[model samples]
Target: MNARVEALIEQARGMTSEERVAALDALQELVAPPDQAWGEAWARESEERLDAYLRGDIEGEDFDVVMERMRQEFLVK
Candidate 1:
């Protein structure tokens, strides 16, 4: 392993069990792949958007209206 990783591992080894668990959790998040992190962020954003839509904080066409518009655009092409 790289020197930094080796050093980090040694530091983790010196921690207490509870600290190790927290450290492991933090490390896992730190090393998580970008796409996995992005997926989580996107999920959170989607939930927030849905909540806002439900609360009428966001205004937009409904799904059927969107679909109909898409169909008309496709037919024109």
Candidate 2:
């Protein structure tokens, strides 16, 4: 890690368990990618599926069919 992050970690290490947990949680969340990014990615994928359907490369229900098949074939009971 870089010097600033190392310093912050050292400061957190000197705190009580609750304080350390709070500081670490704050730092982790600040560095974490947003859930919206995944949502947008899935939206793009859904658009691609719709396009493929329109182009006649696949059927209209292809997305749902693939999902149902995966659920039946791979998902555990």
The best candidate by TM-score is 1
* Candidate 1 lDDT tens digits, 1-77: 99998998999889999999988787777897358788999999999999999999998788999999889889766
Runs with alpha carbons beyond 4 Å of true place in candidate 2: 33-77
RMSD of 2: 10.2
lDDT of 2 at 53: 86
Once superposed on the true structure, which residue ranges of model 1 sit more than 4 Å away at CA?
1-34, 74-76
lDDT measured at residue 58 in model 1 versus the true structure, 0 to 100: 96
Best by lDDT, which number? 1
Clash count (model 1, backbone only): 0
> Candidate 2's residue-wise lDDT over 1-77, tens digit each?
99998998788778999998887778777999458989899999999999998899996557888899999999999
Per-residue lDDT value at 42 in model 1: 99
